[model samples]
Target: MTLPHVHIIGTGLLGTSLGLALRRAEYPVTLSDQSPTAVRLAADMGAGTAAEPSTADIVVVATPPDVAARTIVAALDTWPEATVTDVASVKTAVLAEARTLTGDPVLARYIGCHPMAGREKSGAIAARDDLFLARPWVVCSDEDTPADRLAAVVALAEATGAAVVHLDPEFHDSAVARVSHAPQVLASLMAGRLKDMPADGVALAGQGLRDVTRIAASDPGLWTQILAGNAAEVRAVLADVRADLDALIGALDLEPGALATIAGLFAAGNEGHDRIPGKHGQAPARYSSVTVFIDDTPGALARLFTDVGELGVNVEDIRIDHATGIKLGSVDISVIPSAQVTLTEGLAARGWWVPEAAIDTEGRE
Candidate 1:
């Protein structure tokens, strides 16, 4: 039997990412976008062929929330047999608009979905085949949804190696508003405040500032639409955060241990932080450090890895810290077990640079 053809509307990041994943899996795929250039770029990126929408077995509307409903409704109207799903961020408004577009209950092919995977970038240029890998994809299925259609959409998620999660539209919006939307707003707002800062002041930013505000580079035009569409839920979540901040501020003027109450609040936050799942749904892996001095040259680390591969000891993780205008850089290789003297000697014999002392791994292995 032949594989079903999947049609994707909008060849932006999410759409093109999904298309590339599906196409890589050898699934027949069709891509459409309002921008012919984007569609062509997606095609070149191995997403799929630029084809008409009527020839698909599944139609995924991967447009922004503002346009998803109309596109989904039109696709369903135009392709009756196709199972329709959307990758919109906001669900409630889109679902309501979609229902309004289709009067008959038979046109029940629409299933609202939001994939919790994206980056600080946009467009087909940033589309990666593995973008959805190990990500949570929320599928909002109502009672009217067809069994086969639900399965097909879930299969699409599985095809991209994503975890499928079922959620009610309202609950989905509220949850995302708390975790995702709020963070985006905070990051962007914080970064915006630094606009007038001196170049030297901004240049003094360290990794902490980079980590916190990395997401601020996201497309403002797209995010403005998303934040506006789900303003109610976003504001609701932000209100609680505002209240917490207000309380913390009030505690600041208190004498010495008079701020114990504020510290207690942070203790609660620490517990919440610990509750988050570790990597790969398992306990977090511990690391032991092996620091090496690298010369400031391209492919130096690659040559070091080639030598390390000869030793047959796997490096679990690695970090490189380069010194400004210095001839040498430090690369810290993290292994599962502590780097033994024998391992160090073997690496040094192969002309690899081993530091006199290794960095501590916080008692981890």
Candidate 2:
């Protein structure tokens, strides 16, 4: 099949990553950005050559949410024959603005898209060719969007190894506000509390704290644009979160039935967490975690994995917990419940330390 030549505007992380993915698949890719240095850096990093004054089969506007509509309209005007799409996180406002900025024909060729993939970091330097692998890429199409243009956008998404889902612009905006935007805001708020803490207090942090606040390291300028663009939807979700916070705070004051209310909140949180899909979009499955102690030295992890491979046991997930002030670490390997006994026996017989009491199906030691 003949692949479309992809012209990407805005050489930030998403745009550069798209260029690299397309180029890896042997599709012709051209890259351009308002920042001359960014475009040059992206090209040097094997994303694509600097875009020349030429036509393309598809134009991808991977700009921030604030400028997405303007960039999409401009791309449609510049590449009249190409299907234009934008990878902004928000959709409804961009689509609405694009409609006001251009006529029917131009609007017909433009599709709004959002790739549910990114790191906490930003810019071309952080772009990875496989950034979209196994990630959800939302294609938002209105009734006016041309069928062929929509298909072109889907094909582009697939080329980057993304699972494509079609959604209306309004629904896409609201859904992301709940899942993506709200979480970012919460993470930032939590991390903000650490700013005034003593160094000794911060030193006591662990994996749980790291996981919760990881996205707080994201680019604030970019997030400001994203949060602003989806303000209504984000605000709606935040209001619910705020109400829950108020309830918890009130409970802390020892109101009547306060303990029950707090316990109910915890229970609800656990249920919500379990509802999140696991690998391959499957329903969450219970896995048994096998904790193995290892020396903090090179090749220790490799040997463990090799032993697990030899035993024909697939490791679903792995977490390493390094003992503070000790030359030891614990490797927690998650496997199917049925394989727990066999894996434990196999590793123990191989002279590896497998604590008999550490094999738990509940994923805790």
Candidate 3:
């Protein structure tokens, strides 16, 4: 029996990553791009077949917003044997364009998709097979969409270790406008303010600024297309933010204890922030730190955790910086606040070096 072939169009980060994931799972893969270099590189990186997409069972259009709709339309029109999907950020416009381009004939064979995962990186070279792991991959289907198409897309997403979410295309755009696009614009705007400041000014920058503006480093060419495609929804969110900023400025001007009134606004923000899921859908949990030196050997991490468990301390978080081909590892374990001292001493006495046991006191850590 022939293995199912999955074709990925536009072998950029998302496309190549998906291809890498599908290929790793033993599915047959084919990769294509207008750039021969991109196609060659992604294929060399074990992403796909490096052949035309006409013979695949799945076709994923992962191009930029400008061409994503037409790309999807072309896939549906050209590859009726394949279940069609896209990884474009803005779904509403692409879906609308696909509707106009293909009419009702191929709608059921096409599913609108967006994987809510990315890094401040681009191109096939930056693609990682596990990039979509544990991230939300949304599938939007209209009433006319076929169950098999939706299931195929969901299966692809699940094979990449992503959780599948279903939503209407319109709501998906609006929701992302609030959580994704608005943040991108806001980050760009904030980072833009740093241009005139002294170079040393950024040297003094803390993780807070980095956290808020990290997405500012995204590709401007790609973002221009996305913001343009989802202009209405993005503008709506920005408008609401503008109104809040104006109110906040007005509140600052109030005399004396007038500042106290706006405290509720901030407190509300804090509460709402806590309600959002943390890493792996867990609630927001804070941790105290215990820094340890790890031997660069197999099961070193396992031993560290075992030692920590012996101290009756639960590790709430952990980070490891083990450079490739290096013989030493720096591991920071985050435990309950009250257990930091006990765990630190226990690990140190067990011949593990403990440096800073205090909470990092900064950064998202």
Candidate 4:
């Protein structure tokens, strides 16, 4: 069977990545971009041919949020028979703008989607064919949407190995505002503080700071467009954050009830953190950690995991922290609470050096 021809616009990270993934799925794909260099780069990277298509079965607008709406309108007009979709992070405003720009019934062909997958890097150079693997891809379709058109977009999203989720456009915008845009602003703000720090202070940074500031490395030009497009929604989330910040500051200065305020804030954070889904979108469940000391050598980590697997305890998650100024690392292996004691004892019996405190899994239970 002949797969649908999917023509991608913009040829940046998402666009190129989709083109690459679709091509791998045996779909006919053509790519174009405002920058000829970008399209050529994407093609050279095996994404697709850099050319304009007379028509396509589907047209994806992977341009930045600022240009996404007009681009969607253009795609609809250019390919009246094609199903169109945009992967812009902001949805409500983009859909509204497209609705305003076109009076043609082709407007119904335009579907807004946000693939909740990206990296800190940008451009075709950083594009990966598996970028969307197992990531959430939000499809904003309503009762007014045509069944075939929506199905085409969903198929396209699933073709890239993404998990498709249906959501209302307004709700999609509001949700991303709190989860994505606001966090980008906060990361950028926190990262900005490190710029003027003393060299020694900067050198002291560890994985914790890296986790918080990682997205701060994303494109400023693109983020400015995203934050501006979702200003009202982002502002709402930020306002709540500011309120919490002000309350904390006031408590510190006012002295009375200071400790209670701090404790309450931390407790609120813990409650919120637990709401985040675990691996494979499962409900969050408390897992017990078994930290093991391992030599910082190539096969050392693999050997430890092999030993753990032999012990028959499923590994839920893992983290490794290098011991400062030493050629040793501590690997924290998270497993179901029930398996904690067996895994700890099993590893120690195998000479894996399980920490004495970690061996007492009852405390964590």
Please list the Cα RMSD from the true structure of every candidate, rounded to 1 decimal place.
3.6, 1.9, 5.1, 2.3
* Residue 303 displacement in candidate 4 (angstroms): 1.5
RMSD of 4: 2.3
TM accuracy, model 4: 0.93
Q: lDDT per residue, candidate 3, 158-198, as tens digits? A: 99999999998899999989888888899999999999999
What order do candidates take by lDDT, descending?
2, 4, 1, 3
Write the residue-wise lDDT of candidate 1 on 282-328 in tens digits. Answer: 55555567778888899998888887787787876777877777888
Per-residue accuracy of model 2 over 1-365 as CA lDDT, tens digit each: 78888899999989999999989988888989989999999999999889655789989898877888988888888888989888889888898888899887768888878899988788999999999998999988878777887887898899899999999888998988988899999999999999999999999999999999988998898889988899999999999999999999999988789999899899998888877776648877678888899999999999999999999999888899999999999998889888888899999999999887454654332
What is the per-residue lDDT of model 4 for residues 1-365, given as tens digits with 9 covering 90 to 100? 66888999999899999999999998899999999999999999999999899989999999988889899988888887999898998888897788789864767777889999888789999999999999999998877789988988899899999999999988988998987898889999999999999999998998889989988888898888888888889999999999999999888875878989989999998788778766758877678888899999899988998998899989988888998899999998989888988988899899888886344343232
Candidate 1 Cα lDDT to native: 0.84
Q: lDDT of candidate 4?
A: 0.88
Clashes of each: 0, 0, 0, 0
Give all candidates' CA lDDT scores. Answer: 0.84, 0.88, 0.84, 0.88
Deviation in Å, model 1, residue 355 alpha carbon: 7.3
Structure candidate 2, residue pairs in collision: none
Worst-scoring 10-residue span by lDDT in model 1: 356-365
Q: What TM-score against the true fold does each predicted structure earn?
A: 0.82, 0.94, 0.81, 0.93
Name the regions of candidate 2 deviating beyond 4 angstroms. Answer: 357-365
Candidate 3 Cα misplacement greater than 4 A, ranges: 1-3, 199-204, 286-314, 318-333, 336-365
Who is ahead in TM-score, 1 or 4? 4
Q: Model 2 residue 323 lDDT?
A: 99
lDDT for model 3:
0.84
Native-to-model Cα distance after best TM-score fit, residue 324 in candidate 4, in Å? 1.7
